[model samples]
Target chain A: MTEPLFDRVALIGIGLIGSSLALNIRANGLARHIAVTTRRRETLEKAEALGLGDSYHLEATEAVADADFVILCVPVGVCGAITSEIAPHLKKGAIVSDVGSVKGAVIDQMRPHLPEGVDFVPAHPLAGTEQSGPESGFLELFRNRWCILTPPEGTDPAAIEKVEAFWRGCGSNVETMTAEHHDLVLAIVSHVPHLIAYNIVGTAADLETVTQSEVVKFSASGFRDFTRIAASDPTMWRDVFLTNRDAVLEMLARFSEDLASLQRAIRWGDGDTLFDLFTRTRAIRRNVIEAGQDTAKPNFGREPGNGEAAPGESTGS
Target chain B: MTEPLFDRVALIGIGLIGSSLALNIRANGLARHIAVTTRRRETLEKAEALGLGDSYHLEATEAVADADFVILCVPVGVCGAITSEIAPHLKKGAIVSDVGSVKGAVIDQMRPHLPEGVDFVPAHPLAGTEQSGPESGFLELFRNRWCILTPPEGTDPAAIEKVEAFWRGCGSNVETMTAEHHDLVLAIVSHVPHLIAYNIVGTAADLETVTQSEVVKFSASGFRDFTRIAASDPTMWRDVFLTNRDAVLEMLARFSEDLASLQRAIRWGDGDTLFDLFTRTRAIRRNVIEAGQDTAKPNFGREPGNGEAAPGESTGS
Candidate 1:
């Protein structure tokens, strides 16, 4: 067997991403020991029952004891609290990172609590499904996906490299950018999409003219895709919106303005404008397929690492 | 083999829905002969090359000649022209049906041209992928989806039943509703969703702050789903907006009001409002899942459907 990359890997908040990392660590033997911790005892029990780690603890301090690598996998709003709780217990030369969607806020909240001996590296995997919790994760979730790390200035390079290698072991391609850039990128890609989806679904739900049953019945026409994305974990998304308020608001403002223009076009019967915008968006979908982000399948498999392997994978197309 | 339901089946505008119906009719032997016609000669040639019909015609009159069942599958905007052109050629007892998204406009456009002995029925099969064109169709695309029929009052019940049976043969569950209600229902379910998806993708494309490359690179979080729907055929969707103008505008107004409230919530850091909306949307997703509208696999099998037969049959989830 290959030698373990680290003596101990502490995962603070054993949810979807955390448990997936645990599975990846065990599957690839990336760490000699795995420490799983969460704020809730029930979730911790679920993680332990799934045998997702070598050790489990309710307290962040208990979980981080002697850990060489620590990854924060909690909701972004909770990251600051977890960081403060675990800071004093971090081992010397430990590397601390996260899998939050909003890097700027994650860095802002988490960087202050980090001890001198530990490196606070903010990261987002650019991956997820609507499902959450420990049972919803798999080792292959990160395969062929992007993991972006946003380390602060003057952070240790060796620590960054080790974390990079660990993610690569889990089958991710790594990219480094500033936390601000990550927030801006995701605001357009992730946050705005989720917001619009949630907004539209909410709008449909509140419609007096059309019932919810009707929406569900006729959803195959295109509304259902938005519903699936809007169904993502409420707590996680709430935290994402709250923490990344500025970027999301900025993106939302732009989206609202654009939507208003579209509304006017529809009002005045401007089919040409509608067609032009619709045609331009097709190129983006093509680019996504080329990036290996969107598969060329007639129907894309949902849920991370489930059903069938991705097109880029060797098992099958 | 089952007895043919109609002596001749004429399909106008042989694109995705029409082509799929052609395949379904041939595979199931639902009609004794299929006559396919499209406005463009190139599309008619492609249909002929695919052996999609017993006879192919560029003129609507030729396609409808001697046909007992004539199904119009063109964009809603062009319904009137095709109906008026083929009116004199339609058989005395023929049933003229359409697969338009907006029923009231379709009825208004096509009804005046119908002969006394002919029945005009409007129906919408709530199914499709993002891909369009005649080549981007399969026999099973309508399997288990809803096919809504709107027959004007005093129309022959026999004609409606026959059309309903045809959809059932194509593997759809049929629902009957008034043309007015159908327009409103679709405004919320189908039209509004497409409008929002197109608007958001357009917003991202037009952004000065977030580059298109950045949007394409990180679309997986949620934006990509909107792009897939937004990538649907521009002409078809453009017609949907123009023909269903009033209902679409009404729904668009409701959506804007709700979006404004959501915008205010986000700006004010009202987490509870965001959380509640996010939570309510999950139930709609569950309803969609239970209704068998969403494809079962996560990511919609964008992987294996491109090549392999994935484990599950694709039910649009």
Candidate 2:
């Protein structure tokens, strides 16, 4: 077995991503001491019951004491407040990072609160499920998944390597990207798709002609797939849209414009246009299957039997 | 075992649904003689290779000759032509039904061509996968699913009962409804969902800012689900939209209005609205599960490694 990556690692905000990281770190012996913190007392107690960390702390400041690396795993909206609350307690030369979906806002929000001696790295782990909360997490959540780190210019190379090594130890492939680029890429890929799902579900629910009962009854055809995504934790998504407003809105504008064209084609009964677009999308699914990002299992590669993936079989590649 | 439902059952256009019905009929001894017809000679040959029927015919008229029951499984656009060709050859007192998604248009198109002696029962088996073609089907596809038969007014009660009993032997729960009601219900349940999926996928593909590669890379989050539905047979979907235009348009209009409201909420950072909608959608999913319309398995109840349930799993309740 490999040596422990860090002597002590602190996780602030032990939600789905955070608890999963702790579980992975413990399962792999990646850290000697794993300290966890969450804003809610009940969540900390639940994490304690789940044995997600070596030590649990409700206070953000207490969790980071004596930590070699501190990873903030709360929602993006809370990153700044948590950083400010814990900044004074961060150990000298400690590396601070986050498991946020949006990168630019995270840096802007958390960088100022970090002490000069500590290295502040903004990282986004492109891994999650529709299920949220600590109980929904698993040890293999990040395996073969992408963990992107966006470091501001002139950051210490040693600090960057340390953060990269930590994520790698947790079974992730590390990639370095600019904060803006990360946000833009995610806006198109994750953010826009999520927004669209939420909108469609909302649309289906509000229909007077098509009762809610009917949408649920026949959802298996196509709509049910969107429901899993749409049913995601509303708080996390609200923060995502608010923080990543520019990029998300840009993608939405493009999406709306394209949707209008499709509406027009449908109205005009243009089979050729519909056929061309439908044919092109098939390649993307093939690409996802090939990348090992998705399993070939029928019905979106949802693992069978258990609600989650089998033991040691991570959803990500 | 119960007696065979018909002396001879002729299926015109043996695609996924048609082929599946043939296989189920054979497995359950629902018919003594099965006749298959397809526009393409290659499909007929392939159906023969799979032993889908006792007799395979290229001519629609030839296939229906002396048949006690004839089912048109062709696209909605071709229903009228197939009905006209097979009308003269149909045996008197035979029951004729179709597995078309849009019942109203199908009835209108085929009603003129049907002989007075033959009963026309327009049915929509409320089940299917994204896959198409004969090889893509299996015997247990309709098990525990709903087979909705929309018999026109003044139809013989015995004719309806025989059709209902045939579908039941193929592993379906039978329901009788008017052709118009079937069209409206399906417009909300299946047709509108397919259109939205196609439209969204088209939108994603046309984005200049978000390359196709990025969409594929980050698709596991939400977009991949839509791609699967969008990848369904183009001709079948085009025919569905064309035939179910009014109900689809009405449902689409409602969907669009609700989508616009959700967009406004996102723009204005209305977290309450987002949360409320997200929370409410969960109830419908639960209702679907309770109604046995959705499989209890995490991913549509098709578990990996469980070959038994996977092959013949019901697409509907």
Candidate 3:
């Protein structure tokens, strides 16, 4: 067997990403020991029941004892507090990271509290399904998907490389960008898109002219597509918006301005404007397909009788 | 073999729906003969090459001659002129229908031009994919999907029943509603969703700060979901907006108002407000799943390794 990459790996907050990493670690022998910790006793017991970790701890400090690597897999809102809680317990030169969607806030909240010797290499896996909880993850979730690392400048290069190798072992293509760029990129690609989805679904759900039953009965197209993303973990999404507020707001303004013009075009019978925008947007879809970010299957490869395999992390983390 | 449902079936446009109907009719022995026609000689030649029809005609009048059933599988914008052109050639007592998304406009467009002895039933098969044309059609495109018929008041019940049976033969469950209600229902469910999807994709494409390549490379979640629908046929979608103007505008107003409030909530850090809407939308997804209108599998049953069959018609007609 290949030598283990680390003596121990500590995972705080054993949810979907955490559990999946636990599985990956065990399957690949990435760590000689796996320690899982969560605030809730019930969740810790559940992780223990699933045999997801070699050691389980209700206390974060206990979980991080002698650990050479620590990854926080909790909601972004708690990252600062959790980092403070685990800071002193981290072993010297231990690499620390996270799987939050918003990187700028995650870095701001996490890095300040991390101990001097520990390397804080912030990570954001652009991979997830609508489902949450520990049971929702699988080994293939990160396969052929992007896992972005936004390690602060002048941090340990060796630490960043090790984390990249670990993610690659979990079947992800590694990407590196600044925390600022990551937040900006994620705001347009994931955050604002999710906000609008949630908004449209709310609008459809509350309309007096259209009953919810009618909405459900005839949800054949675009509405149902939004619903999947809207159905993502509410708390996590709220944290996402709260953390990445400025970037999301900027993107939202742009989206609203564009939508207003489209609305005006419809009012004035400007079919050419609509047609031009529609045609131009298609080239981007082609680019995404060629970049292997999505499936070439029509309707996300979902509507076909003999369906193609859908691309991973369809909505967001 | 089972007795044919009709002596002859004429498909006035051999596009996705028409070719699929042709396959369904051939597979299930629903019609003795299929006559296909389109304005474009190239399209008719393509239909001929595929052997999709017993007879292919460049002239709509020739296709409708002696045909007991005629389906206008064309865009909503051209229904009126085409109906007037083919009016004199329609056989007496023949059932004529369409597969346009907007029923009220379609009825208003086509009914006045039809002959007295012919029955006009405006139908909408709530099905389609991003891909278009005759080549994209498949036998199971309408399987277990809804086909709503909006027959005008005082129309012949026998003709309506016959049209309903034809949709059933094509493996769709038929629903009947007034043209007005159908337009209203579709406005909230499909039309507005499509407008917003198209709008967002346009917005993302035109951003100066974020490059198009960045959008495509990081296109994993909500943005990618929209690119699929935004990638849908520009002409067909343009027609849908042009013909179904009022209802779409009404729904668009609701969506924008809700989005504005959501934008305010994000700006104000109203986590509870965001959380409540996010939680409420999940139930609609469950109801849509229970109604058999969509798949229960997470991410439209996509993102899973062994994916569930994604429900058909993920985007609008």
Best by DockQ: 3
Across A6-71, the per-residue lDDT of candidate 1 in tens digits comes to 999999988778888999999999999999989899999999999999999998898898999999
Model 2 off-target regions past 4 Å? A301-317, B295-317
Model 1 achieves a DockQ score of: 0.45
Q: Candidate 1 — which residues are off by over 4 angstroms?
A: A301-317, B295-297, B301-317
lDDT tens digits by residue: candidate 2, B63-182? 899999999987888999888888888899999999888889889999999888899888877667666789977666676666788898899999999999898887777878787877
Per residue, candidate 3 scores C-alpha lDDT tens digits across A121-205 of 8998887877777877677677666789999999889999999999988877899999888888888888888888888888888
lDDT of 2 by residue, A119-224 (tens): 9888887777666788977665666667789999999999999889888877777889899988887887678777777777777777766578766665654566
DockQ per candidate, 2 decimals: 0.45, 0.31, 0.46
Clashing pairs in 2: A304-B303
Per-residue CA lDDT of model 3 for B56-132, tens digit only, reads: 99999999999999999988899899999999999998989999988888888888898899998889888777777
**TM-score comparison, 2 vs 3, better candidate:** 3
lDDT tens string, model 1, B160-204?
Answer: 999999999988789999999999988887888888888888888
TM-scores of the candidates, chain A only = 0.93, 0.94, 0.94
Q: Predictions ranked by TM-score, top down?
A: 3, 1, 2
What is the clash count of model 2?
Answer: 1
